[model samples]
Target: MSLENHAEFKLSITKALGDQLAAALKKLAPAPLAMENIRALRPLPGVYQLYKNGHLVYVGKADRSLPQRIEKHFRKISGRRNISLDQMAFTCLYVDEDFGAVAPERLLINEHRGQGQVPWNYNGFGNNDPGKRRDTTEVDEGHFDHDHPIDLEYRLTKLPSQCMEAGEALPLSQLLQETKTHLPYVFRYQASKEFDDIAVEFPDAETTADEALKTIAARLPDKWQITALPGYLIMYPKIEDYPSARRYYRSTGVVDVW
Candidate 1:
């Protein structure tokens, strides 16, 4: 014969704190993630939550200033398509620097892990750039960039320093390198002697990436093509099938080598 008593009390320290933080954040009203709204925020360390259309989607922390960190996100989202800045909102809690060693953002993420909120925390939304090596890699169909690729439309505002004004001719290679540096997203290309020697005149200020690529491609020698991959772009001197390519801009001289 056997007799037993079963009793249990289980709690994780981080999860407990996370639960309380989540509860408190939800109770506070959310404001637009716009600069005007965040401009009023004090430059102090804190944790924050981002919402899309009133639905929680991301959690973050700033060991320095909450305003600066949130502003970075604001500029990034403003350049993308399929999402309106009007749909983004945020809520924040100013925490003592002493409390940050606990990593409040991680704790908050732990609490919401299985709940389907804060999806941006794990998705590529938090990534600034996946880097050049990942350029050839195929993006998962569910990745954030796959759903909302860079808005090449009316997005090429930063011109190369060599050409201060529109309609100025810039060496094709300089244009490629300068654009890669200026764009909020990645722009990768191959190097060649022709790109260095040839100069292409760009269009007006409102010109889009498509227009720019077409201008560049039109000036290139035979067989050159510029392809837009899901997360970035790659330019080469031949037609090639990339599983991740969404669009391709072919050189005007592709039919016959110059």
Candidate 2:
């Protein structure tokens, strides 16, 4: 019995594997992508689909933990405007760990791309901050942040240790540096020693980060201001027009000389 005919079995199974994974993921019932639900699930290796308003918007693969990767998406959405956690959901499937090398995500993405749009993957949804060098460039017209920019009105809580008490003076530099750590979104600022001499306070109770910026500006000398870019915040020593900014903050009160 000689079975040398290999055409029946393709050596490259990447596409077939991707199709199988995609089909499996599509069959799983979507669960709320909220933190509470994600935290409850044990980490699993697999491919997943993210839906916005029940429409499939993204596909991803987690070689190690499904909960951690999806949790990141939840956090990313929580800090942006024009979107809500209630409108988001996800479904996933466990793939064998050995398949991680074939790039399961690419497989899933390719399969889904043939079916419909995977908007987030192309719009830089999972990308980190583009950094200060790219700040001046306009965000791609249809990018995720362009469509649902960061919410300056997003409240601040669980602040880092460097945060100061309401009405308590703290160096502006330290305050800005520490505040960004807890944020689910990006906050960038120009570094300056001058910020060390400036002291600012927080609201009596937890409040919007935008309000904090307003309060911080109250003590900053002339020319120091905070600009609310579409996707993040930037504090600089001088007020210059930022074409990409949604708005700007300035000294709304006279700095106390005492």
Candidate 3:
């Protein structure tokens, strides 16, 4: 079959399944948020749906004990205190084993989202959804094939004077050791805005520029200060050259052979 036909068939099956599930869920009476109702919840793994004024608001799964998880939602221990239980009600389906809750939760979330029902639930309920995939084999090979060098850069504010004392540039070993001990999250350093500054980079897909800057700044010593330059690029030598690379740079000094 053509790819388009295959896709349509799969979508149809998914829609049918979702419709059946939604119908079954609607038949399950919602329980109140009172102490007696909460205590009556089973301790088995399950999928729970929260409703506000008869509208589905959120769907969640508990792999261990359903009652404990539901209690946390009510007591605000799960960081959901903002959710008022005064008009909220819930319904749950107990699963025999923990893994059984996974599909039901995902399906319920997807179904509710399709119907525009759960505005409070962010990005559906599945944990294993593999988001966008990219093929980077050619891109990676091209970098090495073209000998295209890349340097990561970080901007800074309060650089320590002791690290750049005259004729006493810090050794790469010490810098690396200190980094490993205090700033292990820093994976690479490429270039700096100033000779005294160093750069830090993180996976663009996993972290935002602000998040990376905050994390690196928090991990650094109080004596040092770093800043984030969202769109700036600087060049430096490869990390492997660190063994012989100057620990600090001085524009006036005779360049060291590395």
Candidate 4:
């Protein structure tokens, strides 16, 4: 699809999510705030801001449901006397609803806060400038044929080899796509393997190995399943569902049932 069309398509989905989020907020509140009709909550992906009595305080993002996320915050702070939810009279503003969820949350928070303040949440929002792009990695020649469709097993098996050898970071797909020509086969191979290693190094980055598996699962082809094996990640392709993939990968070699 053309870039314009792709953007338009994403916008449509984002707008739908915003509507759903609005509805979810009404049901979740201790006392429902005035629900304004957000006719076009712009299809862009970004962070959302929640205001209490005109002051910006709570911020979050939802890859799937915005309202559901807002509701979660409301439920958490309903009765608490915390510094974060100091004021009342709630309002939500959709800011930076483009690129995706994770970074937008970071950008909005940083836009309001400078270096001295603690970042609101454990997750970091990427750098604020949307213009700054991320890296993308490609499948190596030996890993998969160019004509073949990219799938989970193909990507996971190929990850350690595809990543930056010494660094702990995994480049986003956009960055990999942009820098494909400059990267060598050995670099790509290392990247592919690095996916799991990065997860290990930053185990705290994800709440748990299952969560990391889910993130990795999202990048894989629809058919592949990710299961935790003893001391490694086991991937199986073309399966409808594997209860095993949901199993937790612990520090121990055994895959524990959740």
> In terms of TM-score, which candidate is strongest?
2
lDDT of 3 by residue, 1-258 (tens): 645544333356655755666777788999876567878977888778887778887788788788877775563311121234577788887765734634767777788887788765663222121221211112232221112211222222223422453454443333433332322122334423342343333223333323333434433333333311111111123211222222222222222322
Cα lDDT of candidate 1 equals 0.79
lDDT of 4 by residue, 1-258 (tens): 645544333345544554555454434333223222222334433345555555444456766555555544443333222223345334344444455643555554454465323233422221121120111122233211122211212112223323444444453333323222221111121134333333322113213334434544555444445443211234444342333232432222334343
Per-candidate Cα lDDT values, in order, are 0.79, 0.78, 0.46, 0.36
lDDT of 2 by residue, 154-199 (tens): 8777766335555677777777776676667877777778879986
All candidates: CA RMSD (Å): 4.9, 5.2, 16.2, 21.0
Model 3 vs. true fold: TM: 0.40
Q: In candidate 4, residue 122 scores what lDDT? A: 28
| Model 2 misplacement above 4 A | 1-11, 160-166, 252-258
Query: TM-score of each candidate?
Result: 0.77, 0.83, 0.40, 0.27
lDDT of 2 at 146: 88
Tell me how many clashing residue pairs each candidate has.
Answer: 0, 0, 3, 39
**TM-score for candidate 1, residues paired by index:** 0.77
